[model samples]
Target: MKRIILSGGGTGGHIYPAVTIARELENVEPVEILFVGTPNGMESRIIPEEGYRFASIPASGLKRKITFENVKILCRTAGSLWKARKILREFKPDVVIGTGGYVCGPILMAAALSHIPTMIQEQNVIPGVTNKILSHVVDRVALGYKEAKARFPVQDKCVYTGNPTRPAIREAKRDESREKLGIRPDDFMVLIAGGSRGARNINNAMLGVHRHFRDTPGLCLYHVTGTRDYGNVLKELGEVDERGYYGSSSRIVDYQHDMPSAMAAADLVIYRAGAVGLAEVAVRGLPSILIPYPYAAEDHQTYNARVFVAAGAAKMIEDKYLTAQELIQDIEELHNHKDVLAGMAEAAEKLGKASAGADIAHMALELAGKKGER
Candidate 1:
């Protein structure tokens, strides 16, 4: 049996990878797993639902700007370290693995200081502040994008493991998924999304796109606008769609809980260039139109987007410069050029590593002194 502590939280970007890695580890060995996160982070809900033991600490993030909030965070981090150390001592895990989040900082630090094997994964083109600091002490660093290696301080410790994603995505059936979603066989399905909360710009631009292609017989668009903009988007679409501008070829949903299925059902994906999202899309060999969110921390999404563009798996449209006309044209070009579309899909398949989870899990198991069990 391998005893492991998977520490990560705050955002789904961090939580999902941690969860995926945990599932992989479970499949690899007889493992006792626990997730350490903050009390208020998303992981508190996500982890337990995944059937893993979860613990919380008093951890908080440090702001880039120096302010009273930073002081508060400093005090909280100091307190959390002691609590995290105590938890690790009690749990007596053979190894600790962190997926870049503030909560992972304190827990992994404690594990490192206690002479336990410690590792952390960075799920972005640019490493997070917490992971940057943790990298110095942790035994190994796993990365979703190879471009991230140049950004890390210790290159020797980093491994390009790619990002771990849901197993359902790895095994999804496109035809079955399309049938489940009621998409016609001849329709070219396009999936549009902007993270979980939704991007207002995408929603607005998509309105124009709908107007342009509403009457096109087989070009289907399934858009997931975040809850914040869903009502307005639906109302706006109701008017244009009533005018037969969309010809009932478009579907709008506030949220799609089964993202793996949604990805499986799509012929193309238009999305923000988050490391996790790209990993999922790549795993499915889905060609993408990536619009890097300009305001992302350190402008990392731009770097992530460029990687795919260079690989010929994706095309980039800068958000500030992105127009509805451009979005529609891109869609038109891709649909009209099936050969190019297939080539991009092939590139995506080549870049996508479906074995990321298993590889990382095997490394963790070895660190936990279960070298040959798997």
Candidate 2:
């Protein structure tokens, strides 16, 4: 049996793609797969729940600013590198794939020094520091956006394989999802989510816009105010609605267990431009209004947003200029111009890659010279 090891963590963005690629590979043949991630990252919870064996290393991220913690983190990272080398030796993987994060840095470096065939998947338009370093050593670099290719030195081997998403998002049925979400056939539903942790700016803006649209007919708002901010957002909205009751036309959820239903039900999406969120919107071909997180490393979220805006798939709203009234006006503009919304949806769909998982898996298998089937 062939064996492979995948490493990534820190956030769902990295973990989900690794899981998706592993799933695709398993369909091709029986294989032994091992996942390596940090002990406390999101992968600890997600990978096991997905029914895959996972191992954890005592790895931590280095602080960008000068601090004593940075030295401590560097020592821990070196120790983790030693542990990663031991794991590589014991597993003897035919190939190793790193899906971008601090956890990946040690593992990929170990694999490079071991002379093991390795690949890295970069999910942003601008590569992360981990992937940027690994790009010089890895045999293949799989990119989620074409714009990322120019940022790396090993451009010859880069493949623009868009990010992978949940299978449900790829195969969602529009009417079924709308019905499941209790949305009327003619209602223009707006899906508002601020990635997994929720966005304070977006929540504040939405609160401001609520009063103006409290009685707007044929419009419904589905807001997923992350669990942490749910109570405060509810309180703010209560102040605006006064009745403490938002009618059937508005739903404020802490989180949605089923995002595909929400995405399918939405006529438009207002969200942050995190790589995963943008990729999901693209995959679903939904028209979006993106507000890039200003503090993202190297301001990469802005570059990611530009990819969509340049394609005419989404509108960009800078965080500095974003307001509740401005967001409402933007939504209303899109609402009034169905033709423009349809055009943007078509553009987003044009940029979507439904088979990215299979593509990345095939590339890894090919690099390993194990073309059994796929």
Candidate 3:
């Protein structure tokens, strides 16, 4: 059996892709996949829930500004490298792959130092500091966007393999998904999400959107409020409508377990510009109104969203200028023009790489096979 180690963490953005990649690898190959991540990251819980073998390693991110805490982090990172190397020696993995996050930095670096084939996946247009630094050493650099290649120094090593997502995303059926959710065909089926933690600004704007569409029929809005803001969001939503704006056709919740089905049912997506979310959107050919989180590292989310805008797949709404009025107006324009929406969906469909996970799985196995040949 070919052995592989996948390392990534810090957030679901990093963890989910690694999980998807592993799932794809296991589907068609006799592969022994191990996930190496820090216990403190989302991967600790998520990886285990997915029934994958997960190993924890000590790691942390370095602050940009030099300070006492940064000095401490530097020491910790140095220490983590030894731990990562030790894990590598023990596991004897044929290949190592990193998606992103600081947790993967030490592990990927160690793999390269040990002369084991290593690859890092970049999920955004503007390359992150961690991925950018490791791109020089890794055997391959898998990218989510074609525009991202220019940001990396090792151009030849970079390949546009697209971003991987859950297999359910590809197999979801729109009619079945809509029926499962009790969403009417007339309802617009707008998906508004800011990830699991929720975005306060986006939530604030949605308060107005609810009132704006309160009486509008065929507006099937599905909102994921996120756990952090669920309580307050519910309380305020009550002030706008005693029924809480939720009925058989429209609903808002702290979380949705069936995101794959949700993607299938959605007619439009209004959310942050995370690569994973956009990948799902593109695969579904959903036209989107992307509101990028301005505070993301290096403002990478904005750069990522711009790629969709340039492709006519999505519209960019910078967070700094985002408001209920702006959001409502854009939705009105798109909803009123069905042809335009269809055109945008076609553009997004052109950019979808639904087989991304399987493709990357084959790539890693090929590299491992080459090493075996040598």
Candidate 4:
């Protein structure tokens, strides 16, 4: 029997990748998996709901600048390291794997100090401070973006496995999804989603996009404005149906629960450049206009978008410069030029790593085997 410990949290991006890897590990073979995260972090709720054993440690993010709080955080981190060590000693796992999050820092460090086989998966082109520090101690580093390797201190240990996405993302079928979404075969479906909480800039820009395409035939714009912006976005585009449909061409929603189906039905995507979202876009071979969130840690979202831009899979529009005209122009260019759209789609397909979850799981098992041999 193989025992594996997975640690990551704070957000869905960190938690879901660990869940995907756990599912892949189970698919490959029978294994006992334990998820470790901060008690109040999002993972504490999400991990157990996914039906994995869950554990918690005291963990918090470190402030970037030198401050009095940094001293207190350092003290708390030391206590978390002791707790993590205790958990590892009792669980006696063969290998410990971390996805990026502040919570994973002490756990991975504890595992490394115990001489346990350890690995960390970095999901962005710009490595997070926690993952950057852990890279020195972990045995192997799985990279969600190959471009991220140069940012890590120990580049030799890094392997480009790409980011793991939910299985539903890969399983959603375009024709079926399009039919379900009431989109016709001849229609060009454009999906605009700014992460879950929603981007106010994207929503504000789309007020013009909806008006421009209102009566256009053969073009469908599906916009998710997020909860905060939903009412305002709907009110601004007046004379809409109860279903938030405007004219013959646009439908607006507060949130999209079925993103896989949305992506499956989309001809083009206008999205924020979160690593997990981009990973889904890549595997689905969807070309995108990326607007990276300016406030992300270390400006990592911009770096993540650059990889896609460089790969010819996406066009980047920085948030500061994002306007209705810019979005409309990009949409027009892509809409009019089928060749450019097809080429971008092809480039996206080339960069897709549908096997990333399985690859990371296999790597974990190999490390487990190495530990046994030693």
Which residue ranges in model 1 land beyond 4 Å of their true spot?
240-246, 370-374
TM-score on alpha carbons, each prediction: 0.95, 0.94, 0.96, 0.97
The digit string of per-residue lDDT tens for model 4 on 31-97 reads 9999999999999899888999999998988787999999999999999999999999999999999
Query: What lDDT score is found at residue 181 in candidate 4?
Result: 83
Q: Which stretches of candidate 4 lie over 4 Å from their true place?
A: none
**Model 1 TM-score relative to the real fold:** 0.95
Give the clash count for each candidate: 2, 0, 4, 0
Instruction: State how far residue 247 of model 1 sits from its true place (Å).
Output: 2.6
lDDT of 3 by residue, 1-374 (tens): 99999999988889899989998899978899889999777889889898988988888877778789998988989999999999999999999999999888999999888889999999999888899999989999999999999999889999999999788998899999999877876677898899988988898898888767875777877888899997888888674244435544347778888988888999899989999999999989999999999999999999889988999999988898989999899889999999999999999998899999999999998888765553
| Backbone steric clashes in candidate 4, count | 0
Candidate 2: count the clashes.
0
The C-alpha lDDT values of all candidates are: 0.88, 0.87, 0.88, 0.93
Task: Give the higher-TM-score candidate: 2 or 3.
Answer: 3
Return the TM-score for candidate 3, rounded to 2 decimals.
Answer: 0.96
Q: After superposition, how far is residue 308 of candidate 1 from its true place, in Å?
A: 0.3
Task: Give the worst 10-residue stretch by lDDT in candidate 2.
Answer: 239-248
How high a TM-score does candidate 4 get? 0.97
Q: In terms of lDDT, which candidate is stronger, 1 or 2?
A: 1
